[model samples]
Target: MNRSVYLASTLLICGATFAQAAPITAISELSMSHSFIINGGSEPAGIEIDTEPNSLTQSADATSQVDRPGFTPTDTSDVQVGNSFSDPPTPFEAQRTNSQTNLGNGDVATASYDVSILVENDPDIGNAEEDPIRRAVERSGIAAVSNAADPINAEAASSFTNTRDYRFTNTTDDAISFNIVGQFEAEMRAEHNGPEGFARTSGSFEMLFETGPGVDITYFPVAPYLITVDEDDPGASVAEMFFADDGAIAGVTFSGGASAIADGTQVEASLTAQTRYVFSITLEGGASMLLETAFTQVNAVQVAVPTATPVPLPASLPLLLAGLGGVAVLRRRRG
Candidate 1:
């Protein structure tokens, strides 16, 4: 059987005095993605069955390359092109995982996943000392909750990507099943009364699967909802909206503001049923919060199944049904 993939999210609410905002230098923008594929060929004429599943696997990998622009002799901020420069490249990085499984019986499945958070900060926010983006970058820990110095700047971003592939052989003597899984999640938390906390995410996935030969496969229902909120709850919150790709996939949209008296606000996002989580939690005197989390998991298997045979019904069964019908007919006639 093919397991159905789902997208969902949850919120873990915490309370604390809003803390002060941290100095942030994290990248003002980011982009990330994931993908995979599988193909199957004809089955050989053999009198044997296989029981093992082979795989092409990829796990938590954060490999990336950095490229900073080169300066010309006259283009240098200081003197000559070779002059030492004090500026760094814009912060844009990505990570991903991909995997594939092959059943000896001519069946295959492939999956891919990736997620990232990007923050754009203003150099004018207060230089490196007061700029929220730069200070956040200084820490290698959880990302800092800070926005671009202004809306005109690059808006902070969260990215997610996923792809899947599956194929099965053409042998009637074999039965196989495959399930592709993809997931992602991210969150931001702030102590109430002081500092500010924020979080947001955006992602999408594509998957494919197939059963071998004349084998049969069934897929479960897709996930139904992502975030369930009462827009009327009104405390210190924003707008929560949704978009769907028919019945196969869905997306979430959020917006809100924070203030002193209001403790905090959270945004939980779910990409798949099982989403890996990346979060940044902080406490401030005036705390405001935002969060998102998600994950996904599944397995594909190929195995022979016994066909069901019909047994002849007892001769008395038909007579018994007819007798009951006769009694009901007689009652109606009396009426």
Candidate 2:
């Protein structure tokens, strides 16, 4: 064959081999969901009282009365909800054998005071304490309290009592909120040196919350758990998923914007083995959203790797080579 024809044939063969060698594979595709719970509580309520000496009689044939102070244990548990109590248990009557104890030798009168405060519709379980979300709530609550108090009298001795109630509800269609309460017990000791010499005083206290539903009672800093992901159909694309505490999705990350996963978008997620992911997806501008959970599927594609494809050579190379060969054959025949 002529030089042109030989070059053309070589080009055609290279194009076919390059096309077969091209790689077309799918890369990584992953889906994930965030699990959340809602928690809240009402304000505490109580009362305070102040008393002063009323009278004093001197060394004459006269009588006088003195003022005394007393306080009753406020029934904080009455307004508290979701706390469990033992049945057929010993009543306070058994606990308190007598009322009124007197100390010191002096003619004294007593003043008794009682007050009550109400707290309603608060969250008591998940997200109720030092968690990130609860921290924000606590900070806000503290700010409100600070603003309400008199700055000059902030440290004055004042009696405070308040009854609070809390509730936790699972609103997610596919997932349920697990409500838990944690109790912390600790002791603090301090040593001081006075005219009497070194002395140490240690105090211990316990805090309890009346969970309206039940008491979970766990330690602080609970470990994280696995959130599930939903499965996408073959060749189908999933856009975004919404997450909420106790299922309130509004104004949350899933509401919209950067945090949302849009159509044709890619997501990379690393999940612990043997863990589950529960997710809910609400389409853009759609009225309803779908909730799904990930499970162990043998054929499920956990990871993906993308492949690259090569460029194809010109298609006219083979035709050009055949035409050049025909010209060479004609010239040979004429000769």
Candidate 3:
């Protein structure tokens, strides 16, 4: 599983770093890409979902993007895709409610969501068509969103909504709490890129989350479970936590740059931009619901250092630029 591979590699790398450097105990892969069951009650009233970033903003070069998860509750015993509620369950990132669509047909059984912003003009232009995530999904014969839409106007959202069973989405900025039957272990993470380009670290560079300009990342008073720096896949099954000593999380952060080189051209030519950052989780607690502002950016791209000639940026240049500032992998696990 990619989840296990992600945690295992993080453990091996960060463990060594922390051991050698004052026992920092900080892991490089602070990103997340898994979901937990919301089985909290005989029936859950609703799940409180928030995709807003809870990390701090330390510098201008950093960026952290949030990927939303789909809500999936069975209308029947069989766990078939048709039985699930939300459209395209994996990689969900919108904020709609049961009115959109849902499962079980109960008063609040279904829900739906639509993208608010697909692309940006101020910083990254014509990014939708070049979306790496979307491209990856398309390769699997499924459809998912990158951010906004075609002819993407400055700040307009999409018009379509995903309605399905156990409704949930990759929505941002707001927590939509609809009547639900299960208690979800909802966790937020700096979403990552896969093997496609510079890797998942592109979106996670902004992982150093902060609730306020100078405030620390802490747990919400009413959180159901203790928020800690832990692994997912093998984590849920393993006895001990994957990353740290199962340290409780106060906040999340990142520190990265070209170890060999920083120039965009050099990184691509050498294929070294993939491994460019290290993520760490701060040990703090006693809070929940975090917020911050972020700019829409792409990951570090695989620049083909021109052997003899310089050329214009491709239509995919926007996506390419987005890839410029992310994870140091293999050394290579982004969120």
List residue ranges in candidate 2 displaced over 4 A. 1-133, 136-175, 179-187, 193-207, 211-335
TM-score head-to-head 1 vs 3, winner:
1
lDDT of 3 by residue, 1-335 (tens): 23323432443343333332221111111122211112221112232223333322222121121222231332211111111122332232232221111122110111111122221111121123221111111000000111111111011011121111111232333332321111111111111111121211112221223232222222222222333332232111101111211133322222221111112221111111111112221212222333221222212212121234434333233222223222211122223
Top model number, TM-score: 1
- Runs with alpha carbons beyond 4 Å of true place in candidate 3: 1-90, 93-250, 255-289, 292-335
RMSD of each: 28.5, 39.0, 21.3
Worst 10 residues of 3 by lDDT: 136-145
Error in Å for residue 100 of model 3: 40
lDDT of each: 0.20, 0.18, 0.20
Instruction: Compute each candidate's TM-score over C-alphas.
Output: 0.25, 0.16, 0.21
Per-residue lDDT, model 1, residue 174, is 40
Which candidate would rank higher by TM-score, 1 or 2? 1
